[model samples]
Target: MRQNRHITSNVGDGASGAVAAPPARPADQERTNSPGLALGAKAAGLPIAGLAALLSARIVTDELGLAGYALFALITTLPALLPLGDLGAGAALLDAVAADDGSPRARAHTRGTLISGARMLNLAGAAVAATGLVLAGTGTHTWLLGTAATPSAGACVAVAGVLIGCTLPLGLGASALAAIDRYHVALLLQAAGSAAGFGLVVVAAGLDAHAAVYCAGPLAGQCAAGAAALALAARALGMPMLRTVAASVRPGQQGTRIMHLAGPMTVIYTTSALTYGTDRLVLGHTTSAAAVAVYSAGAQLYRPAAALLSSAALPLWGRYVQRRGAGGGTPRGELARLVAWFAGAALVVGGGLVACGPPVADWMLHGEAPVGPGLMAAFGLLILVHAVNHPVGMWLSDAPGLRFQARGAVAMTAVSLALSVPLAIALGPAGPVLASALAFAVCVAVPCHRRAFRHG
Candidate 1:
């Protein structure tokens, strides 16, 4: 009788005649999170891409000589500021998209934000390109690097400016793609386009074209590849007509939120640019182009470590946001575990870099350099500090410490100039690292780590 009853229950209910189970969740279909894996893999590729680009630059620089190299960096850097003219839109759009994942609202916002950001960047880039032409026409050629006095040099600057201006819209799209977790596609596009750009530079060099052509090649390729991505994203999101979307969306307050978030970041990035980007420029004033090249080479050797470390933290940060939403406070145990994980990885990776620094430098530079074991050790120590500082500092904005985190960022900025100047003088190229280490140690790590364990 019991078996008969069970069989009847197992049979379809009278209403539908189908035995029903809960719907399969999108997450349940995959044991591991696909997006997370994609992000991690993309993060891993950063080191490889950075290394390849550096090598490509080195090859072109070697072929054209130091004048070619300096001109390339200068031309590239000049246009870089043009792309940044989008203000905080890129960061804002990413935040909005990530916040609204998995809904029609998310789809709408993503499409609208992307279109707005791209258009803004494109216009800005074009304006800058126009300015470059005017400068060239007016004989204000001093800003054109090696072409300062020569007509051909001015022409080269104008061309490079145009290429850079064209790239802004595409670069904006690349950033957007990365934010949407299309990491693999983004990486592929970046690698192929960047490589092609290098080839373009080499070809231009062979023709005895000004080094500006080498600078222009990558920018042109980036813009071209980026257009494809923008199209793909636009289609995927089912974006409405630009006018209709803007009229319907309430992006004003949301835009403000994004600026609030990105403003501090902008400051931090600006300071970092000053700290690091100014290295060659400052050296240029005090030293020879060869010296700048040597410093740049050493700097490049450490670039992989720096980039990978930051990349690895980013997706983990997204997870942090999700977890914070679910809980009242940051789980102390979880925070500790993550911190330890970062520290351990940093130790292993930093030790390896320190061990291999000299050999790697020799290979990259194609000869002996003054970059020695001490410099490597200094680099490793910086990485170690970053490993500890990054997570702890990030966690300050989570859970019970949100206010503290804001205060901490402000404090860090307040003290940055005071902290950085002495360290920069004391350590030369590695001064920023020391300053960063000290900032976290004093402002974030010392306090947060203690508070996290106090409740236990």
Candidate 2:
């Protein structure tokens, strides 16, 4: 939940550009890449997804109580930590497809990227599942969150691990849709999944199911959505997006092309996870498990809101990539638009949440861990910092851009690690938020904006 939602936006971020003449829009994608269908769907779906997330949080809090809510948060938030869970292979495919020229060779490259990336994701999934089982066997899962170990905790972690494993590759469907300018299509499907997950959680909680079983609701919805999205993309494009599951694609390329981009991306994701995604751990170990829950009260709203804000701007990344490929970079006007939308969105959403979140959280949390304006404001500040960096971050999401961000991210991680513990100790729930925000704003947002201007 503490993941840098801005950076994660790149993985599935980007919308199709205007329907005007341009070399940026792939000849084949013209029909599906229209702005209305892509962005409109997202604009509509964002609310449902956000609502589902909020309702799910209420369900968890009411049924699971404080401990259950904390566990649920950890399980759901773990995916944000494993940034390289896909081995960055899916991103490689996105770049390939986005930069394609509608030639047979371009199609071939996209195919190769998908097949190879899928192979890597499959392996990564197995490894994660095995590691989860090992952790369960060793009885270390319960102690991971700085809490005492117990049999049930171990079992829960193990189950969470296996579920995460299956989800790793399934996420490629969404990634594929993004590459082809159907990001909004994936977003709509994802919203449906979130809504479905909410229904499942409600039913399960009412039936007295284990908290763990219902936590899987969201995961299952996401998995189904991903698979369905990928299948749709594959059928539309005639690409073997699903062939990686059964080794149907020949294994001749050795997958180096796919790894070419994934390697550096994984490094960036690693640094990002270390620098920004460790919020819960910092609180859990440095403060207490209860502190983690307190943070989630505000974070439950902050994370999704921040992510949606970035996502709304994500299509700009794809547009920039395609435009640059055609020797037409983004307009200065486009930059201004991003700055306005994200900043304004952050202001409105953050303020509204601060004003109203407390009452809603009280109802949702049942007073497990108190939520006040201070915590809400800290996350709001983080969202503002995210707004500052999001536009430039879009331009810097390519291979060379990843390399640049990776260097700064390493330094930011150092600063975050040095200060996160102390801040958590001092500020309770808001300390890490400040530390992360400060480090990113100084070390990341500033330099990236400068670089982007120079690139312009």
Regions more than 4 Å wrong, model 2: 1-39, 148-151, 248-256
Per-residue accuracy of model 2 over 1-456 as CA lDDT, tens digit each: 011001111111111111111233223344224444655776687788778877888777777767777778777777777756577776787777677665546555666677677777777887887888898888777666554233356666677778788877777887777766677888889889888878888888889887667767887777778788877776555544565444523445334376557877777778777776688888888777778887877777787677667666666556666767777664667676767777887888789778987776666677766788878888888889888678777777777887788788888888888888998898998898889888888888889888887766
**TM-score (C-alpha, index-matched) for candidate 2:** 0.88
lDDT of each: 0.54, 0.71
- The digit string of per-residue lDDT tens for model 1 on 133-158 reads 88777767554343213335566668
**What is the TM-score (0 to 1) of candidate 1?**
0.71
The weakest ten consecutive residues by lDDT in model 1 span 1-10
Clashing residue pairs found in predicted model 1: none
In terms of lDDT, the best-performing candidate is 2
lDDT of 1: 0.54
